[model samples]
Target: MSTQNVAERAVIREARPEDDAAIGELLVEAFITQYAKKLPEVVYTDERKRELRDVAARRKVATILVAEVDGEVVGTVALFPPGAPGSEAWLPNSADLRGLATAVRFHGTGLAKPLLDAAEDLARKWGVDAICLHVRKGAEGVGRLYMKRGFVREPVGDMDLPSVFLTAYVKPLK
Candidate 1:
């Protein structure tokens, strides 16, 4: 991230099959860091790690996107198209955004915003009228980020995971 503007470190692009492993590693690392302070147990669990590792096998790479810096995969996000099988619960003409993870070292390097913009761009390309994503209740920073990006909280489901209450937000595409 040196010698160029902070945002120049990573170049966002469509992810390929070969990127699956790197993306999984990024997710595991980020998830572990996220839980290290409060939910340390999650950091030691292999079940979740294995599930993350199986992402490539279960998901279509074409539906994934990555951010690379000097040939290293540093961030990943998934944009599920409107009406996609697993995304049927979303409002009509609205796509879903999930699986957002970024390398720890790249924090504060402005890598995430571009990746998010890319995801929204993808949703708009699908001719969707809006895009939706979920954020855990306590993740105020994440919520603020979404709000800053025009997302408005619109609670949807009660299927929360243990202590983490999941809430949905939607941002209309114009």
Candidate 2:
């Protein structure tokens, strides 16, 4: 599908190796706003930044899609293959969706919906039975979007991050 059709000003396409840097930049910018002083500095350091960029470049079992406007990336979403290693163990039966970010400038533009639509479409194509994602507390807007998109919240429990209350959102693919 043509990216222009989704959003008049943005184009959605599969992320390429060259997009690693741009995607990493977007991640840092987007996360910093939500995480602010709470997130560790190392998470945004050059080395760890490169690691994220590399992950986007490798693609691995995770499919990363980007949204660009006037040749600049403004949003991104990633869907990992079911059963992929390091996948969210809490939702072992579901495909893991990650790195859903949109440039702050693009906020209220509905750019995120198309990115998510692409992820869900890709997940269905991969024969995934369900989709799962983690949203930190205080990110009510993000959670509400997923809820509106048909995702239901599962119980919170053991996880890597604390008080962050790993809220698992799931949506059946089939």
Candidate 3:
């Protein structure tokens, strides 16, 4: 699939074990920037970084996916099956979707939409009726994108940080 970015020309697919490092890099880059602006107190330490890498390597969810362009990883999104052991507020009554990250260099080139589409396809394949995610209230742009794609907001409580209410968004897959 040709994209506006000449360097990107591929479809999204399941993430391979070998992609853990690349995926970790993408996540660190994307989240570091976002968290720096949103939640400066959220420290991304070495242990936390290793934990994320380990999760990516193990592929515990069976739904981790990555988008590659010309053999270079560009973006990724994963749908955690319902009943997973986690306290993610957005995930209540739905499959928890997380780890939506893209290479810093590939932002604003429309790669995210395709990644999300692939994630939704996986959720449907797993027989999940709905998929959900959380976005910080300050990140209105991110929330708007999900809203535009048919996601509706659900009530969520404030997290540990003030002014950072967890805005849960859900999209019905059925």
The lDDT per prediction is: 0.76, 0.75, 0.73
- In terms of lDDT, which candidate is strongest? 1
How much does candidate 3 score in TM-score?
A: 0.81
| Clash totals in order | 0, 0, 0
Best by TM-score: 1
| Per-residue accuracy of model 1 over 80-164 as CA lDDT, tens digit each | 7777766623577788888788888777677888899899888878888988888766666777888999999887632376646
lDDT of 1: 0.76
Better of 1 and 2 by lDDT: 1
Model 2 lDDT at residue 12: 82
> lDDT at 133 for candidate 2?
86
- Structure candidate 2, residue pairs in collision: none
lDDT per residue as tens, model 2, 93-139: 57888888888767667888888888888888878788988887656
Lowest summed lDDT over 10 consecutive residues: which window, candidate 1? 35-44
Order the candidate numbers by lDDT, best to worst: 1, 2, 3
